[model samples]
Target: MLPLALAPLRRLFLGLALLLPAAGCSSGGGSGADDAVEAANAQNAQKIGAADVTEKQEADARFLVKATSNALLEVELGKLAQARATAPAVRAHGAALLQSRLDLLAALRALADAKKLAIPPALGEDEQEAYHEVSAQTGSQLDKHLMALLVKTQNQDEDAFDDMKDDAYDGDIRGLAAKYYQPIKAQLDAAEEAADAAEKLP
Candidate 1:
């Protein structure tokens, strides 16, 4: 009876010893699975952040270009109205500058389409037609504006030029240009900061 009881105890000890390593392996496997999941999640987060930064950079560039173009156009239009001396070359150059603006607008539209962004409300049918016509023209409108101003300045008729300047720039045009430029510049700066922040994260 004593031997039989001792045999049962020995068998029980052997069985427990075998199960110990398997239990340890299971715990290690669970830890490995957890580590893998964490690494995958981290990788996904990084990709998402990078994509956001890229998108922001593109948008900022677009806004900057638009603001700059609009400002230049306003200045040109002011000069055109004020110039007392009108030459064919001056008009041609002015037309060319206007055309450049159109080209820029077209490019913007194409980019927006590619990115699935909305078309600007200000871009109307006439604007599009004007842009196309400008692209087709040979001369630079910017040069024309400058030449006209130079001719007027050479004449030294300050009073006439001054009066034209007043007529050219109404309160409404200047105000609108400033309003658009300022807000877009602010947005661009913020987008840049956001991109920098994304780079820092993780």
Candidate 2:
């Protein structure tokens, strides 16, 4: 009974009319979902805020992490030197260094526990690479490689400890740094001597 254009208009209106009730019926559920999402966002924000650490705390934590890894590397290298080095000077230096590094690591672990900082349980990528490189050599080659690596690493470690001793914001971290700086310096000297000895070897 309707005109063609008017029939299409009627169908369009009927479809909208059908959709309107469905939209209205779903509005409450949509609002509830939005509220749940908002609440979850608020809770996450609160949790993040609660877990946030201060900048100084973060610095101290980072130092502890690096120090732990360095100590582990030194310990492993020291063991390797004792087991694989051909020179008496290298082996004796390794033994002394190993004992000192073990003591340092023990102290560092205690301090890290007190600060609630997490330390990695093994060597970092660069440290592993250095270890593997030194391990690949034999006899005098191993001694040469080990001494060179020790000189480089000990210098780096000494510098780090010196900086931390002078500049650390945390009192405990400063104390640890001060405690180790002299020993680290001594180790660096020993490493240099070992390198010299290795160089003189035939």
Candidate 3:
């Protein structure tokens, strides 16, 4: 039982208690548990975003390595052809190839850096073995082997460039592929012509 004088004060306090939850609802309901859950969800989303970025970087790095390694192999073999070729025509062709590869390599490295990709200086295992095999030969024998190697290598380059031009996600890589496609195709044709002629030589 309440005293008569305190009864009105008690009723006013009860009315205010009823309105407190409604006021909290109007103010967007900042419960501590709700805040904790939201914070946890935001943290998870951030982690997922970071993972996506890392995965993309890794994928771009792999593609850059694949494309650039093959180009580097050709450049190495062209250097060998320059030193070991008996025919002046074949030596000249090797010089042109070396220049083309150097130009493309510079462009690729710059583009890869901008795109967060890492490339290797050494060729992969099988290619390194192929390089060693070519390096063992001398003179006209080297010329024949180098010309055949160039024919096969340039054919591979032509196809890879075409595929990259179609599939590349980066604007610069796509542009580079588009820019180099015709040159690579021309090299393939030249290599084939040289290989055929070399095959006829004694």
- Highest lDDT model number: 2
Candidate 2 lands at a TM-score of 0.72
**Which segments of candidate 2 are over 4 A away from where they belong?**
1-55
Clashes of 2: 0
lDDT tens digits by residue: candidate 2, 71-164? 8788988999899899998999999999999998899879755543445555655567678889999989999999998888788789889988
For all predictions, the C-alpha RMSD in Å is 29.7, 23.1, 23.7
Higher-TM-score candidate of 2 and 3: 2
What digit string (tens of lDDT, one per residue) describes model 3 on residues 16-91? 3333321111112244333322332233233323432334323334456656766788899889878878777778
lDDT of 3: 0.64
Whole-model lDDT per candidate = 0.34, 0.71, 0.64
User: What TM-score would each prediction reach against the true structure?
Assistant: 0.26, 0.72, 0.68
RMSD of 2: 23.1
Number of clashes recorded per candidate: 8, 0, 0
